[model samples]
Target: MNRKLIALDLDGTTLNDVQQITSETHSVLNKLRDQGHIVSIATGRPFRNSHYYYKQLEMTTPIVNFNGAWCHNPSDKDWDYGYHKSLSRDLAISMLSLKDDPEVQLIAAESRDGIYVHGDYVPYPDFFPDGVKVSKQLSSETLLIDPTSVGVFTNTQQNQSKIEERIIKHYGEAVEVRTWGGFAPCLEIVAAGVQKAMGVERIASYYNIDRKDILAFGDEENDYEMIQYAGHGVVMKNGNDKLKVVADDLTGKTNHDNGLADYLTNYFNL
Candidate 1:
């Protein structure tokens, strides 16, 4: 194999049921490194949120976080110099216009913190827990700005699709709507063309690894494009079907079963 780099998505693929790495994964990864392969993470989480996990795995490669909004080495003291996306107050307000629709949940994201809600009237100070910073109430009356990912939640799958469709029809040109997780109808808005693929591409380009020589593994709708760009993409058995379709081969085991480690050990002869 001409593979030199590998990008692994965190959620449904790498992180298991208890939200952690498998021992077998760590062992195999060490073995891979002994053979001179590069490994990295492509995730939707922020750097702070991902630090503990990175340390736990003893990861030294760049991390693609916030769906590729940030791509830098979290291990470095300076978190400077990486790709990023910032959502403005106006976009938050525009999203607020649709809050009357019970199906829509508007959220705004800040470069530094947890999700926030958008509003007009003064909500109960306790509407959110302490530590979540609100943008502030505008004089326009009844408007509130909270940094969060807008979502459409419903008990009914069909209604979920309808709601997603609505958001796309209205904001398709403005923002990108992505279905979160495998087979989950919940939708989250991200910067247009922003996903792990963007981050992975940036890192690969910097290292001069051609797209076809890069290996990636993932298991969600967000991972679709990532698999497309990598040369030796693998999908966990539990991954979303779309991911499976593009993966060069199927690992045939889930994270709970230590599938990734098993596949690497055997396929790469590590």
Candidate 2:
């Protein structure tokens, strides 16, 4: 059998509704790895937030984090093929300026140091991990370095759309914007041309795996490029409707029902 490279998006995909990987999914992934298939995570989450899951899976392959703004092999300190793309400090400052709008409740920037939040807003504790500092100011002077990604949070869907539109219009060709639904109204802004597909392509090239031998799984706007790039793009049953339209196939079960395990079990004939 030809070994394949499998990329998984964490939230609302591999991870269930309760934010835990089910035993069934875990076993299936382990079985795949045992069969010599390479499995890696491609997520919009930062390294700090996604590290726990990466460790849980015992993955040695490079991880795609911050929606492809950062990619690195956590297990290999000597690996020099890592990619870390960030928005320019000026562009980051432009994004941070959105906090002035009343519709924009909060804005945050992620860097190697930590997540710097602007304005009078607070994120959940889980959003900030150990050693990841959380600051109240994200000014140009304070942001000594460029940011991997910037996030805008709004109180309503309408506001979310407005902010996204405003930013995209003002920062055209400078950044990519994506919105998240179902939970809080939020938008993730990253450097131009940054996408999960880029990370997948880089890893595939490094491993000498053809695109046709790649399988990707995702469920949200951030996963768009990756799902389209993969030979077999599997979208969750509970995935965004837009994503489902472009997927090669859809899982019969939802995330809460072990969707990933069920799909891989049949696909690999495990």
Candidate 3:
């Protein structure tokens, strides 16, 4: 078989319940890498949070972070095929309107530069281990540059929907808003037309690989584009049914059972 580009989605697809890469998975991926196959991560997580896993897996390729809102080669900072599609500064600052809503807990804008938070509460501390949480709030002075993405954390799904609806109604043309895949009732907003597939394609092009050789595995709404774009998209047994319908194949096991590794072993006969 020809060399392939394997793109992985971190949460609920690559990582197990505890958010660690199991030994079996690590072994299979390393063996594949030793065989000349390329492995990379395409996720909704910011580089701050995903960097550990990238280093843990010992990946040397560019990462698609923030669901393709940012892509860069962390191993080789000199690698120039990087891109960051940020929301306009005006748009980011405009999100401040939601901060005062009683149902809204937090509103944050993130970029490689840093995070600008506009609330008293921090929703997921693990996701922002190095963030400077303050009651200070996001302001034009604090968020000077355009941000790669904006996150609105709400207290409930109903409130989340209300906020999402308002965002779409007002800025539908300029941004893409999605309900984050985590258990938290939050909304993730990125520039319009951005998706994981865009970054994966960029990586494949750099490697001179064709679409037919791209193998991607994912399990959520954010994975929709990449899954459809890959020549072979594998959805886990525990994946969303919407993805399963469009995916080329389905893993017999869930992430907890090392589903990605299982599929690779059988497919490549490793």
Candidate 4:
């Protein structure tokens, strides 16, 4: 179509199941860049985790990280040049009431700086990585630190009602809590206004591209808004069955099949 910008989600959309890009996909992305299509990444992952893929794609567009809590200028050094914008502090406090159980690991985080893992679980430093991990033991008491947003990780994926109830209670009107996906019933908390849509909007504003000229691809809960906002949103064959209901088009293969790269390669190779 006439799309000039492409906002891609990394984990479930761009990368394969193994969380790596196939050379075919990589090569296609390189070609997309050469063809002068603005490509950027919008993800729920922290900025650091998001960079891992941006580097792989050699992306040159701004990155929307933490579901739009922050945006990074692609031209800057790997993790540098991030701009912060988020919800109010009291709203965060109001959201905490949604926690169903104190045993759950509740943590708020800064995009690249760190996370406060609150719970009985003692997370080792490796869980976070080089710069994002705070250099101290996780606090055991009820934490009030304003992280970019709160996150919950548990080993239980069943009991949908309990999980949804907790999310509704904690975030209710102040914050937005969505159960991203986990066989373990994990949830993600972001400022009410923070989402992939916001990130894409920011990126478009920066480049002056209208929503009608942007193309996006994704296949998950976090991807819903971004995919819907783009002019031509594509969903993968392997994406969740529910998302296909909203896709503008469907790619023929799965990530493992290098579907994304294949799409680009075939288009340009024509």
Candidate 5:
């Protein structure tokens, strides 16, 4: 059998509603790995937050994190083809300015150094790495170091939409913005041309796997580019409606039902 690369999104895709990988899904992934298939994670989460899952899966492949703003092989120090794109200082300041808007609750920036939270925004300890700094005053000087990604927090969907629109209008040519609805209604801003698909392409190229030999699984707006780029893009039953329209196929079950394992079982005839 031909070796294939499998890219999976964590939240709302690989991890069930409870935020845990089911026993069945775990077994299926292990079986495929043992058979020489490449299984890796492509997620919007940062390395600090997603590293635990990578370790859990025993993945040696480079991980796609921050929605492709960062991709690197944690276990391979010699892998130098990794990518870590960040927003410009000016752009980061422009986005951080949104903290002044009444509708915008908070602004958070993630850099290689640490996470910087501005205003009333307080990230849950579980999601953020240790030594996260909180600043009541966010300025261009404070964000001089370019960040991998910036997050704009808002309470209402309307505000989230407005924030995304404003950001795109101002800096659309230099950056990309996507709303993360699975969690809070927030806008995830990254450098332009950054997407999970880009990360997958890089990893596939490194492994000498053609696009046709790649299978990707995802269930959200952030997964759009990846799903479209994959040879066989499978969307979960519980995935977004927009994703379902563009997906090559739909899984038989939702994430809660071990959809990934089920799909792979039938696809690989396991």
Candidate 6:
């Protein structure tokens, strides 16, 4: 096979139920890297929460974080061919209004600057690395810089959807809103037209690869655009039903069952 680019979505597609990559999956990925295939992460998580996995996998490729709101290569400080598209600071401040709703628990924003939170809720506590803190309160005054993404965490799925509708209705032209799948009931907002595929495309160009050689895996609504853009869009068996409809293939097993590793092993004859 030619040198293919593999884009992985972290949460429900790559990590198991406990949020750890299985040993079987790890071995297969390492073997692929040895074979000269490019592997990179495309996740809705902020880099702060997803950095451990990137280093653990020993990836040198650019990673798409915050669902492609930010793309940067952690391995090369000198790599200048990446982008960070952030929401206007005023828009981020305006989003804080959602926090006033009874069902909304927290509203947060993240950027290379820092994490700003309006409430105490930390959705994925384990994902955060040590020394990283939710230090600043999210507000017009404290949120001095534009954030790559804004998150609204709610108490229930109904309320989450409700808030998503409200955001679309109000800031339809300014942002793109998506609800997270599997683990939590929250909504993710980024600049209009921002998606993981954009980041993947940039990385593929950096590696001199074509779109037909890209193999992307994901399991959520946020993964929709990236999956559509990839030549081989593989969704986990446990992925959202709507995503499965558009995916080119589905994994034989769920993420917890080492589904990605199994499929890659057979697909590449590794």
Which has the greatest lDDT? 6
Deviation from native of the Cα of residue 99 in model 2, angstroms: 1.4
Kindly report which residue pairs in candidate 3 clash with one another.
none
TM-score, candidate 4, is: 0.80
Alpha-carbon RMSD, each predicted model: 5.1, 1.8, 2.1, 4.0, 2.1, 1.3
Number of backbone collisions per candidate:
11, 0, 0, 5, 0, 0
TM-score of each: 0.79, 0.93, 0.92, 0.80, 0.92, 0.96
lDDT of 3 at 235: 89
- Relative to the unseen true structure, what is the C-alpha lDDT of residue 210 in candidate 3, on a scale of 0 to 100? 96
Against the true structure, candidate 6 reaches a TM-score of 0.96
Candidate 5 RMSD to the real structure: 2.1
Give lDDT tens digits, candidate 3, residues 1-270. Answer: 999999999888999877889999999999999999999999888888889899999999999998889889999998888888999999999998887789888887888757778776656545665655422358998777888999888887667667888999999789988664455567889999999999999999999999999999998878889999998998888887888999999999999999999999999999
Task: Show model 2 residue runs off by greater than 4 Å.
Answer: 119-125, 131-136
Q: In model 5, where is the ten-residue run with the lowest total lDDT?
A: 128-137
> What digit string (tens of lDDT, one per residue) describes model 2 on residues 163-264?
777887898888898766645567899989999999998888888889999999998888999999999999999988899889999999998899999999
Candidate 1 stretches with Cα past 4 Å from truth are: 1-3, 77-81, 97-110, 118-159, 182-185
Residues 1-270 of candidate 6: C-alpha lDDT, one tens digit per residue: 899999999998789988998889899999999999999999999888898888888788899999889889988978888999999999999988887798888788888747888887766656446643646888878888888889888887667777888899999788988777555677989999999999999999999999999999999989999999999999999998899999999999999999999999999999
Which lDDT tens digits does candidate 5 get at residues 44-91?
Answer: 887877888888888888989989988899999689879899888777
Deviation of model 1 at 113, angstroms:
3.7
lDDT of 4 by residue, 1-270 (tens): 444787877765787766777787777777677777788888777765566677767766788877777787856666444566655545544544545564455444343555554444433322455644453333334334556765666546444447667667755776766555533345667777666877788778777888888878887766777777787788877776677788888888877788887666665572
Model 5's alpha-carbon lDDT is: 0.83
TM-score of 2: 0.93
Backbone clash total for model 6 is 0
Number of the top candidate by TM-score? 6
lDDT of 1 by residue, 62-144 (tens): 88876676678766646554656654446655655565666444343434344444543322222243434544332224333
Better of 3 and 6 by lDDT: 6
In candidate 2, what residue range of length 10 has the lowest lDDT sum?
123-132
